[model samples]
Target: MDLNALDDFQLVAAHGGFGRASRASGRSKATLSRRVTELEEALGVRLVERGARSLQLTEAGQQLLARTEGPMYEVADAIAAVREGVATPRGNLRIAAPSLFGQLALGTLVARFRTLYPDVEIEVVADDRRVNLVEEQFDIAIRIDPDPDTALVGRCFARDRLVLAAPPLLAPPSGDLDEVVPVPAVVMPSYREGDIWTLRDRAPRLLPRPVLRLSSLLMVRDAIVAGAGVGLVPQSIIGGQLQRGELVSWGTRGGDVALWVLHTSRRLQSPKVRAFVEFLCDQYPDKAFLASV
Candidate 1:
């Protein structure tokens, strides 16, 4: 009935003393003491026993405390919901990604994400090196690695394949991986596993004649698309190209290279980061989109 007094009594009960409650709530001890007394008088029951050592809640106080917690929490949640709705998912979200992944996939993904949620502006720093996400102040990091950083929590959203691919005009897949490796090819950093091409059933030290060595995977893809060379490329980057007959899978698909969304544990609560992670996962479902695209 008396909400203010009821709140004061709850605070006193929680703190175990009027002086403690007053200090915590920034109210005078006299005010808190008076509020609880008024609450007891209004309820026609004894709410607390003000003693020398501590204030002990009576049976009535205990009952009221039990019933009031739920209502108080509900009120607090309702206020929070409104505030969150007004402010969340509207600020700039900084992302750190590998250069190749950023150019090919993340660019399109971020475009689509912005189209859906216009308020969230994205800033991406593309580099192949693994930067410290927390030190960089990045909201999330898109990484292609076998194992993500141990300090950060990550979600493996997509398992990308390293595929030997070329433009349809160059040469079609004859189901011969050994024959394909000798072909003049373009090579990027990710495709090289300790100086050997990562293709299925591949022989050791087979990649010898890469025609063009580009630093950027995006450039390598362009060269392959232009029929400049046959090369190993990420399935995630070129799936749609393969589907559209722009590029053909020339040789064997390589081992699964996991793509991770890495972030600090503290950043898990960010609304924009959460929304983007879910959005990215939705794009790359369980089944590969290579055939569908």
Candidate 2:
């Protein structure tokens, strides 16, 4: 039968009856009725069972809808595949990320992603504040903690550790393990929670407090490395610095946190978002960070 007839049948099924389908499909009711009649004639079967108030699909129509749905979806996917191939993930990918990760991690990843998907624009919005993914229209968000919204799908890139560290110059006044230095620290704002500055735990003990406070991790890391004070940071971000002796670890293993790529739940499997999430996972392997910690 003609695809136009199938289209009309699909529209009728989708919209429940000819009149409604006609309005939805932008065809007059008479035209839609004629198309359905022609389709049934061509197929040599009555597709719809007529009732006073509504149309119900006959066995043949139900079978046809079932059979055609998969193929129709395949056809649509094929068209989209070609379009995506031609366009090359070619659209703006709006991303929201914390400032430190944006500066230290995403710049390189975005550079590489741009190199691969040259036509795609990576719009990076670097803020320490959380943004509403749906409301803000962000394609992806690099988040450091659990994404509490069930509306978002979180893909694990890697787990990170918060290293409590000081510059070598400011290690300790007495070089004593028990001595805690009261040092200036820039920290993530109280909006994130000020009660706990997380640390590597003993089998029993937990410590949480920062002597001084500020709003951004980037600011905190800079201040720590500059001998301003000891503060927490992701080891993935400061591995090289630790090796270079720019910072010294306050604990043997570092504190724990996970890094995740958060996207809208429904779009988790979208090609562009999927590609980026996989790229991030490959870039920051868990084993490598685990090895460091």
Candidate 3:
């Protein structure tokens, strides 16, 4: 199979059609179409369904693109590095992060990164879904308490602990250490009835009466701030509110959860990836935003 033809086919599929691919690559539409045809002939499979007004990839084309896109970009990066003597952070860097974390922290960090490396382009996808980094072509992923994956390697950038917090007016009065207080609570969808919250070792337990169920932690925090009810929220996210006296922390909940900056476990780390990981570590030098209270 012709590698150049395969590359051209990928370019066309990625850009949706021959004309757009041609415009993006500075190659004529006729040449791109011919290359794709040659690739299909060599592979003995139809890759694209070309139409007058629209273009669609066959199932085979979609599979091939999914399997090869990440490797293709890696190969391109390798070649570019060899040609340039030193690999500088100058290409697109795609990042995947949790929605709340992205909204709370990424804006400032990303802005600082762009100022330092003006040549690199960034795209951040903020979704809570656990993504397959290699298959999805994400350069980096910021995850909280990620499961063990041999295909990935990363460093823990920061650690956070959950705190049962509430507006000062709604917070239950401090009582006996062993007492279980039933408080109206804003809870996550995962919270269940009769579930007792052990905020900390030797600390009083909370029997939360679910007043509101929210889909995201951000929503739960907002509800708690508005005097909805007590809620379990991450200290990193709610620290400012607690310090400003907008909310009162009952106590820490569970063990600390580590925030990691992860990438594919490839032998060679791209300069861009290395730079970003280092920047994250620097930002959280203590590996935690706030101490557990």
Judged by lDDT, which candidate is best? 3
Q: What tens digits encode model 2's per-residue C-alpha lDDT throughout 49-124? A: 8777799999999999999977877877898988776434566788998777777767888898888777777899
- RMSD in angstroms between candidate 1 and the native structure over all alpha carbons: 10.2
Worst 10 residues of 3 by lDDT: 284-293
After superposing candidate 2 on the true structure, give the runs of residues whose Cα lies further than 4 Å from its correct spot: 1-3, 6-88, 169-214, 252-255, 266-268, 287-293
Task: Write down the RMSD of all candidates, one decimal each.
Answer: 10.2, 11.4, 15.4
Task: Report the number of the highest-TM-score candidate.
Answer: 3
Give the CA lDDT, 0 to 100, for residue 80 in model 1: 97
Order by TM-score, highest first: 3, 1, 2
Question: What TM-score does candidate 1 reach?
Answer: 0.61
For model 2 the local lDDT of residue 251 reads 58
- Sorted by lDDT, highest first, which candidate order results? 3, 1, 2
Q: Please identify model 1 stretches exceeding 4 Å from their true place.
A: 1-87, 146-148, 167-181, 189-198, 201-205, 244-246, 266-268, 287-293
Listed per model in order, the count of residue pairs whose N, CA or C atoms clash below 3 Å is 0, 1, 0
Tens digit per residue, CA lDDT, model 3, 1-293? 78788899899998999989999999999999999999889889999999997789999999989998898899889889776633677788999998878888887888899999897889999999999888899999999999999889999988888888989987455656678878899999999899988867545677889999999888999999999989999887787788899999888888999999999964788878888998878888889663322
lDDT of 1 at 198: 44
